[model samples]
Target: MEQLKLAARNARKKTIVPVKQVRIGEGFVVIAGPCSVESEEQMLITARMVKEAGADMLRGGAFKPRTSPYAFQGLGLEGLKILEKAGRETGLPVVTEVVDPRDVTWVCEFADVLQIGTRNMQNFALLKEVGKANKPVLLKRGMYSSLKEWLYSIEYILNAGNPHVILCERGIRTFETYTRNTLDISAVPAMKELTHLPIIVDPSHATGRVSMIESMSLAAVSAGADGLLVEVHFKPEIALSDKDQQLNPRQFKQMMWKLRKLVQFHQQLAKQKSPRGET
Candidate 1:
């Protein structure tokens, strides 16, 4: 808790990282795209699909950090170029993961928001590296780290110079193997009490199943998540990475429809409860 000087919970919320016009901490934001940038056509198609469905921003991993060394290690610079192109074409800001400290400076040229994946959540070197960057950051919770640990890691970025830091709860490692990882829904509200930073959820990574993403996403919203980090692909079956969990275009569109209604309801409810929202 002592390590969380800047990121610690306070009476006043700290900051909302701006990704173009999209505000990360102020209201609900949806960031959707393929887990890995597969190709120009794939990224473009998926980007337009999500944009038409009303996503706030786009996410496509340029440098993926996989558990297996033999797996597809992402397209690197090529993927980043494609991601940036899609973002430009669709008028949506881009967010991508940067694994190596050496790549941070150059990667910022392409990405609007820098992402710290679950594995690198506590990599102090990487944390400090991104912290030095001028861009906003999306820091996912470590697979096995506690809330305190996650906040502590975020402090690295803020302490280094960047104040626009967002928290993403992609789930946690637990004994049960039914899901890819256990989605901690409570963390959504807990983070509200633990830090001034906004928290979003990654249902795609949490439950490595297409069947559960919509429900988990709605649950996250209900639990008070500021936004979502979803994996959407034009063709999930043929995706280069995380295919099983990535939402196909049809599913994503349908999910977006439901999410919009839910978001509207939440907004109305909050307005009614707030003194300033009094009619």
Candidate 2:
């Protein structure tokens, strides 16, 4: 934990990670998009939808690390191109997963934020590579790693000289099989206490059910999460991956409506608690 001093929250101020024009940690930020970039049309439509829904950033997987090799692996570089173009059109910065250390440079060229997925949380080489990249990194906590281990993995990235790291708690594996993964809401505040880096929640992957995402998203914000990473597709029924967990554009817009109110309320409470004249 001492290694994370640079990322440790000080009573004086909070760490605000800047990705392009979006300033995470300043308020409740939302990053929403499809789980994978299936096509040019899919990417653009979803990107525009999320942008309209009030997402601060767009997320899609270009190099997916699927449990089943037969599953829809991402569109590789083609997907990155589509995501970049969509981001340009929608005026939202793009965040995409980079599964290979070798592709970090290539991925950095197109991605405004490089994501180190839960599977690669402990991949030291990949962490180092992303840490060296010029883009901000979204580091997901490993599904099976302990809180300490997760912080240590983050240390790997910070140790490599990247100060722009965002911690994403996408949930962790537990005995309960009812949900795909257990949403560790406590991690939101726990991480805030442990590190100053902006911590976001991924409700889509956490609950693995669209029905729970809205509730969990609200809960996360109330619990002090800095932002949210959601899966929003234009057509979830036909989404190439994680269809059950992806919210359609209408659902996403509704959720955002509720979320915006919650965020405003949360900010108000925060302001009330802070010293007078402090932002």
Predicted candidate 1 versus true structure: per-residue lDDT over 25-112, tens digit per residue: 8778999999999889999999999999889999999898999999999999999999989989999999999999999998899999
lDDT of 2 at 82: 97
Q: What's the CA error at residue 270 for candidate 1, in Å?
A: 1.8
lDDT of each: 0.92, 0.91
After superposing candidate 1 on the true structure, give the runs of residues whose Cα lies further than 4 Å from its correct spot.
Answer: 273-279
Clashing pairs in 2: 7-196
lDDT of 1: 0.92
Q: On a 0 to 100 scale, what is the lDDT of residue 165 in model 2?
A: 89
- In model 1, pairs of residues that clash are none
Q: In candidate 2, how many Å is residue 70 off?
A: 1.1
